[model samples]
Target: MFEEWSDRRTLRVFDPPRPVWVDMAATGMAGGFTPANTVPLRVRTSGARLEQRMQGWQHAWLQVSDGRWVAVVSVRLSSANEQSHASIPLTVAAGAIRPAESVTKDEP
Candidate 1:
């Protein structure tokens, strides 16, 4: 789980098996845009993994699966009266274990 915030620039990253969330608030925009908005996009990983990248102003949500992993990376830019927040959720399996290897050496 990770959280980050900034007045002008902000970046955040989320790790799987944990809850990842972010929030932002902007006041007073130079441009005539009131109550700014954010755009969000997501990318899934191969075989039980999730990945996402965010830019500008955006937020995201991710679902977790059993024996799976998830990750999210995001960035934000804010102006007066325009704030953006982003969040991602990752779920993983609980009962999946990897097998261990045994090594043996023979000496004369």
Candidate 2:
């Protein structure tokens, strides 16, 4: 949960109905990047891969994709039983995370 990259898995953001703040560079900042400086991104209910985890000095962060970091309290991983299906690569840009490939291949 802290100080490691969780296995590549799916997760959904439930709280903060709006898109969550991201530390584009994975920097452990106090308030994260401001809206004016960067576009906030939302995780789809369908979910996306869990990338990396960071135990910051004051906050916990999860990298949902390359260069996309969200606070731990904002999102929840798809339950182990519910995430039996595969998660394709995500296309992140301008506050959205879309599946890059149509096919969903199980992780090896």
User: How high is the CA lDDT of each candidate model?
Assistant: 0.24, 0.32
Question: 1-108 in candidate 1: lDDT tens per residue?
Answer: 334333212222222222222221121111243232332222111112111311221122233434233223232322323333333222212221111122111110
Q: Which stretches in model 2 have alpha-carbon errors above 4 Å?
A: 3-59, 74-108
Q: Which stretches in model 1 have alpha-carbon errors above 4 Å?
A: 1-65, 79-108
lDDT string, candidate 2, 1-108, tens digits: 332545534333333223333332343222333353353233232434343431111123345656566444222334233543441222233332212233222221
Model 2: clashing residue pairs? none
**Leading candidate by lDDT:** 2
Counting clashing residue pairs in each candidate, in order, gives: 6, 0
Error of 2 at 21 (Å): 12
